[model samples]
Target: MENIIKVKNLTFEYTSDEHTHRAIDDFNLNINEGEFVAIIGHNGSGKSTLSKNLNAILIPTQGDIVIDGMNTKEEKYLWDIRQTAGMVFQNPDNQIVATIVEEDVAFGCENLGVEPLEIRERVDSALKNVGMYELRERPPHLLSGGQKQRVAIAGIIAMRPKCIIFDEATAMLDPSGRQEVMNTIKRLNKEYNITVLMITHFMEEAVEADRVIVMEKGKKILEGKPREVFSHIDELKKIGLDVPYMTELSQLLNKDGIKIRTDILTVDEMVGELCQLK
Candidate 1:
């Protein structure tokens, strides 16, 4: 796998009134191309801070961020770095530019000096990718939360970035809205082979990720497949994280001597296991 993003000895801090708060400490990570990575953490756990650093929105006070082998700290490569790794913040309203959804989606390529004629094609293709082509001409303000977020994502896709970093993008959405956004991201990863780094607070939401990276108090605490990481229910619970609902039920069943698997990540899996009871 090609390494798209690398963080070596990355450390960050925030200072107010000369009092420094360590946000990240010697955090190091390597993210591969076309991998669906879910970053889970509680509030103020430096996950958001780490997401920002992925594309140079926030540079490490120490160490460096290399995106596609380009140093994010290099002023000359700032635009290129961003072009390679696009970012989607939480709010749809903050990301949108044009009144019409299609035009907003074209904003990125247009800024990159992509030919006007080609921008239209990219915008249309991107909207179609996210299942938003039908709403391309609709006013962004008139769309639902999920629609708005998809348009925001289409805007990033129009940039044709190699990687997309989402920072708690579903936090403000309803369950359906969250599902919509998550589905779109997953589709992009699977269908288009786009690298996805999503910061999330919902443990259940990450069950489908190719890998899950758990963060706690400015450090990388756990990293593995969803089943492997979530199976450590005790360690996760100790860090203020919840297991998948199905896994929680599986744990209870096991405790009751039902002999169930703790690695169950979905309702269907739990049901299948119960049906196999002898």
Candidate 2:
């Protein structure tokens, strides 16, 4: 797989009157094209800061980040870089600018000078892609949390970004709302073949990813397949992160000689394990 994004010795810090706060240090990473990657860490672990720097929302104090061969620091390519790697933030209300859902979805393409007909087609296609086409004409403020987030995603999709970076976009949503957003992202990757870089606190969400990157105190402490990474139950706990619920249950069952796979993630997997035991 080709590399869609790369970070080399990335470091970022903020200067305060008392002292400098290191947000990221010597962090290096590579994301393959069309891969669904979940970045999990506790707040202030540098994941947020790193996501910002990916498309030049924040510049690194040291090191370089390149997206599709263009350096993020290049002033001329900033908009191009962002178009290639679109970002969806947490607040759905703040992201919905236009009153109508369809218009808001078309907003990005409008700014990009897409032809009117092309913009309309893009809007409809994007809404359909996120299963929000049914309510395309509805007012965004009236939508549910999950619906609003889906609208936000449709808006990004209209921009035709090769990769989408979601920065805790589902954090404030309820479980069902979170599942709605997660399913949208997973489908976008599995069906549409878009690269996904999701920064999330949800361990269950990470389990569906092609790979998981664990961050701690401004650095990359662990990176591996979901099964491989979640297997480090002790390390994850030490970093103030939780293992997936099924993984935890599987671990306890194993300890009690119930004999279950330690890497179990989904509810269906747990159900299968229990049935087999019976």
Candidate 3:
């Protein structure tokens, strides 16, 4: 697969009248096409900062970020870089701009100067992709949190970005709402072949990712498949992060001499392991 995102020695700083605080420190990463990657970290760990840099919303104070062959540092590639890597922030309300759902979905395409007919087609397809076609005529403000987030996602889909960076996109939602968005996100990656870079705090959400990345104090401390990364329960805990429920349970069982696999990441896997022992 092609490398859709590449970050080399990325360092970003937030400067104020008093002093400058570094948010990302010499961070490096690469995301291939159609990969579902999750980034998990504590509040001040720089995951959101990395997402912003990937989308070119925040330029790197040092080093470089290249998205789909376009360098984010180059002013000429700014719009192209953003189009290649769209962002969906934490709040759905902040992203919604139009009164109606379909109109909101059409906004991105319209800004890109898409023709009327093509824009209509993209809007319909994008809405259907997020399971929001039936509610396309409804007012966005009237929809539930999940529905609104799906509309926000449809807006990005209509623009047809190769990669989407979700910066704590499900943070404000209830459990049901988070599941709805997660389902849509997985479908977009598996069915539509869009690359996903999800910055989230939920360990359960990270379990669905193809790979998991753990960051701390502006640096990546861990990177592996879900099972591999979550297996280091102590390391994650020390960093103020939690492992998936099943992984933690499996670790506890192993500590009690029950001898279950320490790397189990899901409920089904845990159940199967216990059944095998019986």
Candidate 4:
């Protein structure tokens, strides 16, 4: 699998007159094309800082960040890098530029100088992709939280980015909105072959990812398949991270001497494990 994004010894620091604060320290990661990776960490864990560096929103203080072979540090490749790795931030309102839903979705391609006809087609497709086609003509401000976030996603996909980095995109959404965005993200990866790097606090969301990376104090502390990483209940708790709900329940079951799998991530998995005991 080709590497869509690669970070080597990436370090980012905020320097001030009094003190310098390191937000990212010696981070290394490679996300392959079409892979869905979820990054989980508490506040001040450097996940958001890492996402910004991926698209050149911030330059690395001490290392390299390559997106689809283009170095983010290069001024000439800034646009190319952004087009290759689009970002959806935590707030949808901040991302939406146009008044109407369809226009907001087409805003990216418009800025890219895509042909009028092509932009129209891309707008339609992007809206449909995120399940917001019917609301294309509606005012963005009139939409719900989830609807607005979907529009934000639609704008990114309209540019036809190879990879999308979601920086806590679901944080401001309600449960239904989060589910809507998550479903769209999954479909984009599984059906459209677009790579997804989602930085989120939701353990259940991380469970669906191909791999989960845990960050702590500006460093990569753990990385593995979701089941493998989340199974370390004590270690994750030490860092103020929670495992998936089912994993937590399984831990309690095992603590009481019930022979159940601690790696259980979903309700179905737990039900199947318990059924075997019957």
Q: What is the lDDT of candidate 1?
A: 0.91
Write model 2 residue lDDT over 1-278, tens digit each, in one string: 88989999999999989999889999999998999999999998999999999979998899999998889988988999999999999899988899999999999999999999999999999999999999999999899999999999999999999999999999999999999999999999999989999999999899989999999999999999999999999999987899999999999989999987888988999998899885
Each prediction's TM-score against the native?
Answer: 0.98, 0.98, 0.98, 0.98
- To one decimal, what is the Cα RMSD in angstroms of model 2 from the true structure? 1.0
Clashes of 1: 0
**Residue 156, candidate 3: alpha-carbon lDDT:** 96
lDDT of 3 at 161: 96
lDDT at residue 189 of model 4 (Cα atoms): 99
lDDT of 2 at 238: 89
User: Which runs in model 2 stand beyond 4 Å of their true positions?
Assistant: none
> In the order shown, what is each candidate's alpha-carbon RMSD?
1.0, 1.0, 0.9, 0.9
Candidate 3 residue-wise lDDT, 1-278, digit = tens: 79999999999999999999999999999999999999999999999989989988899999999999989989999888878899999999999999999999999898899999999999999999999999999999999999999999999999999999999999999999999999999999999899999999999999999999999999999999998898888899999998898988988898899998888988999999999995
Cα lDDT tens digits for candidate 1, 60-167: 899988999999888899899999999998999999988899989988898899999999899989999999999888999999988899999999999999999999
Output candidate 1 Cα RMSD.
1.0
Give each model's whole-structure lDDT.
0.91, 0.94, 0.95, 0.95
- Candidate 4 residues lying further than 4 Å off, grouped into runs, are none
Candidate 2 lDDT for residue 92 = 90
